[model samples]
Structures are given as C-alpha cells and as structure tokens.
Target: MNVFEVRGGKKLQGEIVPQGAKNEALQIISAVLLTPEEVTINNIPDILDVNLLIELLSEMNVKVNRTSRSTCIFKADDVNIDYLHSPEFKKKSGRLRGSVMLAGAMLARYKKAFIPKPGGDKIGRRRLDTHVIGFQKLGTQLDYNQEDGFFHLTAEELKGTYMLLDEPSVTGTANIVMAATMATGTTTIYNAACEPYLQQLCKMLNRMGAKISGIGSNLLVIEGVDYLGGTTHAMLPDMIEVGSFIGLAAMTKGDITIKNAGINDLGIIPEKFRQLGIAMDFKGDDIHIPSQDSYTIQKYLDGGVLTIYDHPWPGFTPDLLSIVLVTAIQAHGSVLIHQKMFESRLFFVDKLIEMGAQIILCDPHRAVVIGLEREHQLRGITMSSPDIRAGVALLIAALSAEGKSTIQNIEQIDRGYQNIDTRLQALGADIKRVAI
Candidate 1:
C-alpha cells in the first residue's frame, strides 16, 4: 500500500499538462480487437487500470509494441479466443470495470465473448444491464452465472437494428457501437453518450473504415462494414484532470497553467468554476489560474442559494462533483452539491467535517458545503481515501489545509491520475509518496 503525506498551505506555481483521457483509452484499446491489422494509439495514459487492460490484451495474444511512454501499437492478428475462458483471463478481466468493453469487440470479431464480473470503486451499484441489453438488442444472446459471476454471450452473424438505450451509458454506448460496427446491417442508437471520449472513439472507428454518422450527437447511425482496418489515433487530453487542476488552483490559492487542456471540448466546466468566483484565463489550449486570497460563491439571480449538479454532456460531470464540493469549502459563500448519477460519493464529506469545514450530508448523493471564506484555516488530519474522485478531493483538501495530512489508500488515485503526486510536486506542492 501507499500513502501521501501532504504539508498544506503552500501556493503552487508552474505549468502542468493533463494526461491522456483514461476513459477514452479504455474504449480505444478494446477497439483494437475489432481489426486484425496494426492499430497505433498515441497519448495513452500510463495508469494502473489502462496498463491492466493492455496486459489483458497481451495475455489474449494481441501483439503490443511500446513506442514511447504514451504511445503503443497493438496488432490483434492472432487473438487467442480460447484464452477468454481461461482462469487467467477471468482473474485479469475482473481487475477493472473497463474490461467489460472487451466483450463488445470480442463478440464483433469472434462471435463469442466471456466476461467475469468487472471490478472497480464501490461507490455505488454500477449495473451491467445496460451492456447486456444493448448487446441483446444487436442479436446477441446473453447468459449470466450468479454463482460464478460471469457473463456469457454468443451470437451468429450479428444483424443490427434500431436500439433506444435505457440510459446514455458511456461504456454501454462504446460497447454497442463497437459491436454494431461489424454487424450485418445498419444500427441506429438513440440517446447515445456524446462525450468527447465517445466522439473520439467514433472518429477512430471511422478512420478504421467504419461508417458512423452523427459524431457529436445523441443519435448515432452506424452502418456495419464487412471489415475494419488499422489506423493511428491520438487521444484528447483528459478533461477530468483539467477540471481537477482548476479546483486545485482555486482551493490552494495558486497560479497554474494547464497546457494542452483540450479547452474546446471542456463544456461548462470552467463556467461552473466561475460560479464559485474563481478567476480563469484561457490562451489557446492552455488554462491560466491566478492565485486568489479569497473567492466568493455566486447566488442565484432570485436570491436563492446556489446549487451545482451533474447532468449528461454539455453539463457538469458527476466525476468532478467531489472536486467542486471540496473547492467550494474555501469560497466565501455556500453551494449545494448534488451528485445525481451515483450514491454514496458524498459520504467522504465526513472527513472534511472532521477537518473543521462546515458541510451537511443531506443524503447519499447530496451535500451542502458552507465555505469558510478564509476566516479560519482548515486543520489537517489523517484519513483514508474512499474512491478515486474522493481521494483526489481529499488530496486537494490536504493541499489547502493548515498542517500535515496523511492519506492512505492512494492506489485508487493512481488508477485514474497518472503520477499525480509527481505532477503536483512539479508545481511546488509539498506532497510525498511513501510506501507502507
């Protein structure tokens, strides 16, 4: 296990670049299985979960070539279909939630996909029904074993039709789109996730000879092609990490320039931070945040308390709600944080309360943070990270606190953010990684 010892109250100043998008890497890597030729992907984040997926691919006989720290070429010319049912695959596939995406590509290419129950942060119940239902809609028969915790899917020449998903699940959309790309007919997916990651996936598939229309919209029409070819694709900068840096600069009172932050794809994130009265200046693809001694929260025009919530795309993302909640702690006013997509993410607010921040856990999915406004500095303490987002939120809190703070279970942080402590240290943050 690893722990982060942070000495707070130090103002960070420097330039940092956001890593490649982790979510996009998952979908893109799995798409390699759709084609037998070589697929070169650039800007892949060297994070724990992604590495695990790459290792899983290698274990399945996909030839992987590492060209650089952030670039890789994958050739799936001889994928071992028999390995899918092996104990090794079962063990490796269950290590990350993104592994479920392999089922879609595997089913598209091999007509059979076996997946163990995927594992990830236990913030809430993440259902696989969306994935299963989407696969069934594409002419795949699904079977599940409760005792063994495995999903077995088989199909004979997938024939696509119209599918209106129950929800616009990010992974579900990617999986169904991948499966539909090689199907026999045109597939129309309504209410698909139009996130930049998904859009990038669509672009990559198109370059690989898949006919996909409506790139950045909810309704996607995928005309199944007989085969897909290899293509080189570059991933966009991680928007979640960019959002995290914005919150870190505000809460710790620092000046940071996030280089190549994919600013155009970041919808409403900076505007949401501005609602917390943080000053952000944009120059091309870089975001500059100036040090602020104090910031004030905005109230509604009707004189009501401010509320920040997550919706689908073009709105706030639920992944950054914890960061928003933590950054609001030092603001001059109050705001309600509502995480509508998942439950139990707000439970980490108790640790903030322990650190002398005024917060009310209204429910499993909502919290009201009363900003201290620098009237008093937060006193740091020891805590355990609950999940990836909350762990980063706690790290931000520690960076802005008064004394020493120790955060355990930092592996969760490593799963998403690549070399986070090292990146923060380059910006003058007093964070040290210690093995325990």
Candidate 2:
C-alpha cells in the first residue's frame, strides 16, 4: 500500500489545471462499445478507476491507440465477446463499479452482457435495482448466477419503452440510455439524472448519430437508431476537483488559480463555497482563489444556522460535502452539513474531531460544525482514507493542520484525483507518497 506523509501549515501558491471529468469519462468511454468504428476521446484523466475501465476495454480486444496522455482512439471492431465470461474479466471488473456500465453497451450491440458484483467505495448500500429494472423494462431478460455472483442479461431484440425511474440515479440512467440507443422504438425516461456528466453523454451520443433530446433536464427522449458511428469528444473539467481546490485555498490560506475550470458547468459549486465566505474571482474560464487569513460562514436569512445538503443536479453535489465540512473547521461560524444521498459519508468526521475541530455528529447523515475561527490550529495525526472523497477531505485537513500527518490507504485518493501528490507539490505543499 502507499501512504501520504503530509507536513501541514504550508500555504500553496500556483496555477493548477483541473483534469477531465472522471464521471463523464466513465460513461463516455463505455459508449465507445456501442459502435465498431473508431472513437477518439480527449482530455481523459489519468486516474485509477478510469484507467482500469480503459484497461478492461483493451482486454476485451478493443483497439486502443494512445496518441497523447489525455487522448485515446478506441475501435471496438473486433471485440471478443467470449472474454466477458473469462475469470480474468470477472476479477478485474469486480473491482470497479464503473464496470456495470459496460453491460448496457454490450447488450445494445451484442444482445448479451454479464456483470459481476461491482466493488467501489463502501460508503453505503449502492444497489443495482435501478439498472436491472431499467434494462428489464427495455426487453432484456435477467438472470443471476449465485455461484459466481454475476448478473446475466440477454435480449433477442431490444424494444424501447417508457420508464419512470425510482430515483434519479446517474449511472443507472446512463446505462439505460445507452441500452435504449439501438432499440427498435422511442424510449422516454422520466425523472432521469440530468447532471452535467450525463448531459455530456447525451450530446456525445448525438454526435455519434444517436438521437437524444432533453440534454439538461429530467425528461430524456432517445429514438432508436439502426447504427452509430465514431466521433471525437472532449470531457469537461472535473467539478469536484474544482470545488475541492476552492475549499483548499480557503482552509490553508493559499493563492491558487484553477485553469480551464469549466465554471458554467460547475452548477452551484462556487456559490456553495461562497456561502462559506470563500472569496473567488472568475478569469475567463479560470477560477482564481486568493489567500485568506480567515473566512466566515453565512447564516440563514431567518438567523438559523446555514444548512447545506445534497440534492440532484443543479443543487449541491454530495461529493463536495466532505470538502465543505472540512473547510468549515477553520471558519468563523457554524454550519450544518446534511449528506442526504449517502448515509456513511459523514462518518469520517470522527477523524476531524481527533484533529481538534469542534464537530457534532448528529447522525449518520448529518454533521454540525462549529468553526474554530483560527483561534486554535488543528494538530495532525495518523488517519486512514475511507473513500475517494473522504480521502481528499482528510488530505485537505492534514494540509491545514499544525504538524505532520500520515494518511494510509491513499489508493482511494488515486482512484479519483490524477497525480495528486505531484500536483500539490508543484503548488508548494509538503506531501510525499511512500510505499509501505
């Protein structure tokens, strides 16, 4: 395992560019399987999860050409369908939750797909009910093999139909949309997830000759197409990283400029940080956050404590709630963080409590943070990363603390952020990756 030894109390200053959207890369890369023609993707983030998905594609005999670090050309012309049944395939796909998306693309083109019990951050109960039910609604027959722990889906011919999703699950919606792309009729999906990543998928599919409407809304209409061709697509900058950088700048009193931040697509992220009294300026497509000695949290209009909660797109993202919580530790007032989407995400606050922050763990879903206002600095301690988001949150806390901190299980952090330690080092952060 690799751990990060972060020596805290150093202010960062430099310009850093956010990588391509990790969420969008998962969906878009899977979409290449819908066509046998060459599909070129640009701005791909060099992260663990996305790279694993690409490796899975390569193992399936997709011709992959890496013309640049951030660009790849994939042609699924000679995909080996038999590889899906291989033990190697199962072992690898089991480690990545994004592997579930391959099912929809495979089913759309080959009329069959296999999905192992997917693994990802153990944040909560992430069920496959949404994906399975949506596929069944699209004329796919599902079977489960208990011995191998895989879901088998087969369809002689997919026929599109209307579906009202139980929840606006992002990956579920992406899977169903891909499966419906080559079906026989019109498919209408209501209550669908309209996050920017999903919209990017729809637009990319349209460029590839799939007919999809309602790009930025809950209602999506996809007309079945006979064939899809190849197209080049670029990903938007990762909004989660942008939000994390904003929080990092505030917490450590750093002057950082995030280049090509894709600010318009960020959707309430900057405003949410601003509510915590973090000041920023927009420079073209960049976000400039200056050094701050202290920031104050905003209260509600009625004098109630400000409550930030996660909702669907156009609302605050659940991924950044941890960043918000950690950033508030050094702020001037109190705020309530309600992580409605995942029950266990707030559990990491216990580590912050050990770092001398005033936090109340109201429950599994909510945390109340009384900002220390820089009156007392947090003292670093040994910790372990629980998930991707929480790992970055802990790294942020460690960076702003008073001494050296050792963070174990940094693989979770590498799964999302691209070359995080090297990038932070360029900004004058005293962090090093050590193998243990």
Task: In angstroms, give how far residue 113 of model 2 lies from its true place.
Answer: 0.6
Point to the candidate with the largest lDDT: 2
Q: What are the lDDT figures for the candidates, one per model? A: 0.93, 0.95
Write down the worst ten-residue block by lDDT for model 1. 142-151
In the range 220-307, model 1's lDDT, one tens digit per residue, is 9999999999999999999999999999999889999999999999999999999999999999999999999999999999988899
Candidate 1 regions exceeding 4 Å error are none
TM-score result, candidate 1: 0.99
Clash count of each predicted structure: 0, 0
List candidate 2 segments past 4 Å from native.
none
For model 1, what is the C-alpha lDDT against the true structure?
A: 0.93
| RMSD in order of candidates | 0.9, 0.7
TM-score per candidate, in order? 0.99, 0.99
Cα error of candidate 1 at position 411, Å: 0.5
